[model samples]
Target: MPRIDWRSDSGSAVAEFSMVAGLLTLLTLAVVQLGLGLLVRNTVLDAAAEGARHAALADSSLPAGEQLTKQLIATAIGEQYAADVSASYGTWHGQPCTQITVTTTLPLIGLIGVQHGLEVTGHAAREVLD
Candidate 1:
């Protein structure tokens, strides 16, 4: 057999490892980012729904619901995500309802993203006295 050239392949393993490691790092970061985005979205949606249910009570008002939503968001994530919260009266399935809307940023790179990139709304039937 002809003499093999080991020197030519000496750094090939390192180069291949570097490329694969970089790709794996990027993939891991992407998965983490996706998870964080989903967590934020679910938290915001839950907060909105809780706020709407609270406002649907007979003694609660739209402003109170908005405040609760803001507080929930601020407590869970940050004050920035609670910046744009609103509550309104509406009808769902012919029944009076309270609606809470939360508009916030969609996290792209570590909680930094385009403004108003995500919007979620929650509703609950209003409580009325006969």
Candidate 2:
């Protein structure tokens, strides 16, 4: 019997690519999703910290305090992403603290909706001045 020539097969490359492409695509999407999640989480944390800092100031107004937190995040992220930001102010350890929570969803074709989605939370605190 003669040895089979694998390279001569017409569908071999297509089949191989089809299998590997799906896995690679999925991996790329996962990485992107993770990066986005981390970025959003950090933004939320920073916003909260800035808000608390403003609130701790001697002459800071409530609306200005809220705007400072929202604006900081809006500058880092764009308007589309900025809309989801929400913050609440409170006291912790005698310090003014702001808890910022940001949430968004990503599309996942293979997983449909479960694994593709993510939720991130962050908190920050600052000492309140008399």
Candidate 3:
């Protein structure tokens, strides 16, 4: 600290600014990624719920629910998210019900991501007539 050469600071400002800008860019991307993930998740969940309700009808079948779920997801998001969709009959709270499940990948980059990144299910009681 005896003698500081001010000339040595040449280009220091630019270097520091570059680093900070990179960090800020990364942070922004992270936030955007999180939002995208949530959006995909919610969309898939809604599709599953719709499928479950459709299948729960007295006249509906499990395959119908699965198809509905896939269609919903395909329409809302894309065909990729609609993959691996399935429907099954089950009992919920001691009542017969239809369950729809969707398995899809998270969007790592614009709806393209790892396989089976997330799985979600929906259930609806069967509509019975007296």
- The TM-scores, one per candidate, come to 0.92, 0.61, 0.86
Q: Backbone clashes in each candidate structure, one number apiece? A: 0, 0, 0
RMSD of each: 2.7, 5.4, 3.2
Tens-digit lDDT track of model 1 for 3-68:
979767676898999999999999999999999999999999999999999999999889999999
Better of 1 and 2 by lDDT: 1
Clashes of 3: 0
lDDT of 3 by residue, 1-130 (tens): 5987887977799999999999999999989988999999999999899999998888888899999899888998888789799888889889888889888997887667888989999999888878
What C-alpha lDDT does candidate 1 achieve relative to the native structure?
A: 0.96
Candidate 1 weakest ten by summed lDDT? 4-13
lDDT for 115 in candidate 2 is 32
* Model 1 misplaced regions, further than 4 Å: 1-8
Q: What RMSD value applies to candidate 3?
A: 3.2
- TM value for model 1: 0.92
Q: Considering summed lDDT, which 10 consecutive residues are worst modelled in model 2?
A: 107-116
lDDT of 1 at 130: 92
Poorest 10 consecutive residues of model 3 by lDDT?
Answer: 106-115
Residue 100 shift from truth in candidate 1, angstroms: 0.3
lDDT of each: 0.96, 0.60, 0.89
Model 3's lDDT to the true fold? 0.89
Candidate 2 local Cα displacement, residue 90, angstroms:
2.8
